[model samples]
Target: MLLIVGAGFAGLSAALRARHLGVAVTVVAGRERAFDAPECLSLEGVRALHDCGLDARQLQLPPVREYISRWGESPMLSRAPPPGIPKNIMLGRVQLLRALRACATEEGVTFVEADELYRVLPTRQGLQLQFTGPVQELVLDASFAIDASGRAAVLARKLGVGRRTFDHLVAYGVRGPVHGLPEGVVHTFSVADGWVFAVSDSPGQAHVCFYTNGRLAGRVTEAKIMERVPYQIRSLMSDEDMWLASGVSAANASTSLLDVPGGTYWLACGDALQTVDPLSSSGITTALQQGAAAVSAAVASLSGNLEPMRAYWLESRAHFDSYVRNRNSFYGFGESAS
Candidate 1:
């Protein structure tokens, strides 16, 4: 049996892969719904899946167009329009969650709803996962465990995995309809503090976020984050915009860093393993890919093929670590003094 914690993209992918290998897989999703950072599932994301032979049609996701941005400039520019791409289709986090859930159900994998995992203990027999709420304190026996619980590092912390802070990056974001907004453009700008982005073709909303420096963390609180959203666009949003009601200004509240520590029965994926600056806009893509990769490793281990775990670790680190180093260098940020 294979046990997976957190049924986000990585967890969902792992569960599917394990079932394909004839391994019994059970997933405990933290929330009933998957929460994708708004606009993280743009056309570029769908295109990646389509290009990999996973039919975006199968998941019923919308088409993502070009990207746009505005800083010192006026209107933003659209990306080079690509052919054969799906038109203006974008799936909300909820829809994506639904699709993955349906896939798992159809494949006969067990999914427990509203399941929040507090800790994972390694016993003589597989892993013992403790849950909060209505779920029982069940101990699952499996050859390996995949931790896809996002940045919380639930398993990483329990297993003593060490994390490293790369650079200081902060972002405040909200979602809403952008009146007269240009479609197909992901606009980015470098500010004195950090940067901001405006992306279109979102799930009925345009997403905007400002990334700032850690030095001003105190001023970037939830009550102040919205102040960072430009006034020229504030009127275009409605009162019901996501994250708008949460607070006026919200600090990014994330430690800008990467975690590369290894464990005997645990592996990390997505932001749980490493968090790069949002400038890359590849967080969701990398998460989906890492989830799939982690599943591959677990399946291999179950089939008496243990080498896949090593390969999975090395490959995942190479991509994320390279991105971190390159971003720091491009922005003239100094390497960690450590």
Candidate 2:
């Protein structure tokens, strides 16, 4: 049996994939994760869901029709996918998890309701998991445990694993009533000092967020973060009012990674393993891919394959390196809108 420590995109993905691989999986619903963040599922992400046997249309996802982007004095550009690249879609984090959880239940994946993990005791055969929720105390043992609890890294932290923080990047966001942008349109633009990303969250609603070093969030303002954006862009999104909404919030957008992603009997996947900038616009996809990748290595090793876990780690690192190069090149225009 295998235990996964989250119910977010990655944990749920791992659970679904485990079932597909004929492995029994139990998901620990550790402290609830906030699912209000806005996300855009890339073409790659759509395929990942397809590989997991999920249908986004049935999940009520809005397919993106176009993307408008501009950066650092560059001309405003409306670009189309090249060749076979499929279109990306705007995704609601909450809606995605709800769909994943529904599928997991239908597939008979056992879910242990718990507030957070209490204690982890190591035994000869495997790991003993403990948790105390508002309802009761519970314990379970598994041959392996996965920390897919997103940024919390619950199980990893309990295992005494350490993480390395490379920077304090964060996204300050606002979601509420707004009008003007057509449904299924995703927009991003870089100003003289920063960048702004906006999506039509739903009918009569919009979500806007900006990335910057967390150390400077206190002095952030609409003008500094959204300056010099063309009227063409401004006409599409009237973001000036979002700043006054008490609904304003902040989410960690830091670029960090675990010092050690796994051990002989456990591993961390998704954000618990590595977190990239939201500017990449592929957070959900990365989590889903990591979950499946981690489990693939686990299954191969279980079948007497040679050190597949190490091989998986190397592949993961290489992916991160590639992501960094792309992100740096895009950000080369200027520092974050902070």
lDDT string for model 1 (140-205, tens) is 565677878777767777776767765455666666666555654555654445566666654446
- What's the TM-score of every candidate structure? 0.78, 0.86
Q: How high a TM-score does candidate 2 get?
A: 0.86
Off by over 4 Å in 1: 41-54, 57-62, 70-91, 114-119, 183-185, 202-205, 220-225, 228-261, 334-338
Q: How many backbone clashes does candidate 1 have?
A: 21
In angstroms, the error of model 1 at 184 is 5.0
How high is the lDDT of residue 14 in model 2? 90
Supply the TM-score for candidate 1: 0.78
| Weakest 10 consecutive residues of candidate 2 by summed lDDT | 74-83
Instruction: Report the lDDT tens digits of candidate 2 across residue range 1-338.
Output: 78888888889889999989889899988655664766788879978877777888787666776676655463211222123334568777888788888888888899987886879999886789888876888788888888898988988888888888766776767665556777666777654434668787567666777666666655766345444345533565556555444455667888888888887678889999989877676778989988887887777766667477888899888887777665555555133311
